[model samples]
Target: MPADGIIAHLRTLTHDEHVEVAGVGQGRRVFRVDGVEIDVIHRDLGRHHVGQCGSCALRDRCVEGFWALRVDHAGGVQPCLLRDDLRLGVSRLLGDPAGLASAVAEHVAAFTEGTL
Candidate 1:
């Protein structure tokens, strides 16, 4: 299938490579190469429909968690798409590495075994 082809191609990426079969909704594959992440999106499976977000402390009632690292909107960039309060202007996001890392750490900490 197409996924097999994608896997085969991914295996060919040599040197400083780590692959994570991502467990998020739609279940993409993430290739980490020298600290950079390359995500390959696949078909949706609705896995997160009843998981992850439900268990996260940062969310409130069906709010999606970790669906995106950052979303670029017409207004600005948002750390979490569902949370308007987390919005950050491009310059702010670029300038605040500590804030970015904290946000990412919080999201990472929220990921459960079912969603990791």
Candidate 2:
């Protein structure tokens, strides 16, 4: 899909989701879903930048910049995009809002079950 398509899809998926914006221009977007907190940290791909990142072509995925979504679970932080299953699942969710809610619920279950 095109960059715009992905952006639109993401907007649709997160439209009703609870979110908390943090930091300045390039900040973090914390999304709360089913008691699970997903922190999406924005990346500033500029002169000074550091962190593990995904290969999504849409350089500016969010308002700040490119983002990396990680789930805050009981055990530890689970990288949402780094894992193949999650990446694919998220892609699927972005494309279909009707299924997005259920998909998120499933993700929560998987996370709590230690399968994600």
Candidate 3:
């Protein structure tokens, strides 16, 4: 798969069940599963996103890869972006600690089972 493909997959992962960990222009942010820094931008803060900030100044530069999302375990919903380096880091972490992925999957499965 292409490099961008990896980031895209990571992005999808966030959209699916993970939480946000970092925001754009907020410097490097870390993830919970592993200590990887991912670049993050707001999804709603897209190019044509004329919501807040009295009109986005960096709208142009904030087009592609604009909004970043990651996971946050603060007991609430948080949006963050998983940068490329972070993504690669997580992929590595999962291999060594199969427990990491299993833990998450098991939790998800338990939740689905409604035994919570």
Candidate 4:
């Protein structure tokens, strides 16, 4: 199933839902399930796309792309789809937990700044 379909099913199972489109742009949604709040980002690759790549000046304005690494069946790690030259083996990704965390933090910081 597509991500949006999965999200829709999850939303049905959840007890509550909310739409957040202010600081976070218009590409996020929140849900509460079993007393736990789950933040789900709806990738709006449609009209709200903010950039051509991750490092574009408008990177932070997008919430529909590159929220996590894509790993294939053979452990091919694709960090970004737009870059066209970024791919790491799963072993390499597993060997650098700190590096992954730092990268995630940097992206989060950028998103937060855009939201703010």
Candidate 5:
């Protein structure tokens, strides 16, 4: 399939399809996509001393719980989004780096456009 086609398929999946709001480390919604670990904040609340991804305006915040994942957008410049962590056991199912790159790009496009 074309890269965009794969992106379209991912866009159709709703929050209920792969995520559930949970209370963990100052409250977060955990997203489980069979492998990757992504914790999203359902509420606009902040985690004291824990740092906020959306609020921090610094470059190289890896030490602050931010990891770099390149995202290629079909439209605008790719935005940087923070992920919680990765599950080692399911990493194999997530696929290789090249495939993951495309997936991440598509994910960014779909997410920023509100298509997913």
Candidate 6:
């Protein structure tokens, strides 16, 4: 999709109590969803890092270590949003922003009911 379309869709998805668009730029966006900050990286811009390394589970290991498989987005990994089951739901929407919005809404709703 076009950049504008993506941005618009993102804004719509995040327009809720559980999610909000924190920032935006070319090929990138940041979201604050359900107390977790999510950075959506769409393309490689030659940058080797993103988000906070301090909170990463694999922080003790080298950058080329085993965690690389899970943390590596197109370019680099950012601090992941949520954890465990919630993270799984969000992770499934990495490439599809529209689906992400729907999933997030569902997740948030489920979370409120203590079911997520």
State the lDDT of candidate 2 residue by residue for 1-116, as single tens digits. 22344434455656544333432224444445455655554343221112222233432443342233454333222334334344323553466777765766665555434465
lDDT of 3 by residue, 1-116 (tens): 22345556566555432334343232222222234445433344233221221243443444333233344443211121322222212333445567656655554343334332
Query: Which is better, 2 or 5, measured by lDDT?
Result: 2
Report the C-alpha displacement of residue 8, candidate 6, in angstroms. Answer: 38
Model 3 earns a TM-score of: 0.22
Q: Which candidate is the best by TM-score?
A: 4
lDDT of each: 0.51, 0.41, 0.35, 0.55, 0.38, 0.41
Quote each prediction's TM-score: 0.35, 0.26, 0.22, 0.40, 0.24, 0.26
Q: After superposition, how far is residue 6 of candidate 3 from its true place, in Å?
A: 25
Question: What's the best-to-worst order under TM-score?
Answer: 4, 1, 6, 2, 5, 3
Per-residue CA lDDT of model 4 for 52-77, tens digit only, reads 34245545553455445566777555
Best by lDDT: 4
* Model 5 weakest 10-residue run by lDDT: 84-93
| Window of ten residues with lowest summed lDDT in model 1 | 42-51
Clash total of candidate 4: 1
| Residue pairs with clashing backbones, model 5 | none
Q: What's the TM for model 1?
A: 0.35
RMSD of each: 7.5, 13.4, 15.8, 6.9, 15.0, 14.5
Q: Model 4, residue 38: what's the lDDT?
A: 79
Cα lDDT, model 5, residue 46 = 27
Clashing pairs in 2: none
| Two-way TM-score contest, 1 vs 6, winner | 1
In candidate 2, stretches whose alpha carbon ends up further than 4 angstroms from where it belongs are 1-86
**Per-residue C-alpha lDDT of model 6 across residues 45-77, encoded as one tens digit per residue:** 212322333344644442221112224443322
Least accurate 10 contiguous residues by lDDT in model 6: 62-71
Candidate 2 accuracy as lDDT: 0.41
| Total clashes for model 2 | 0
Please state the error at residue 37 of candidate 2 in Å: 14
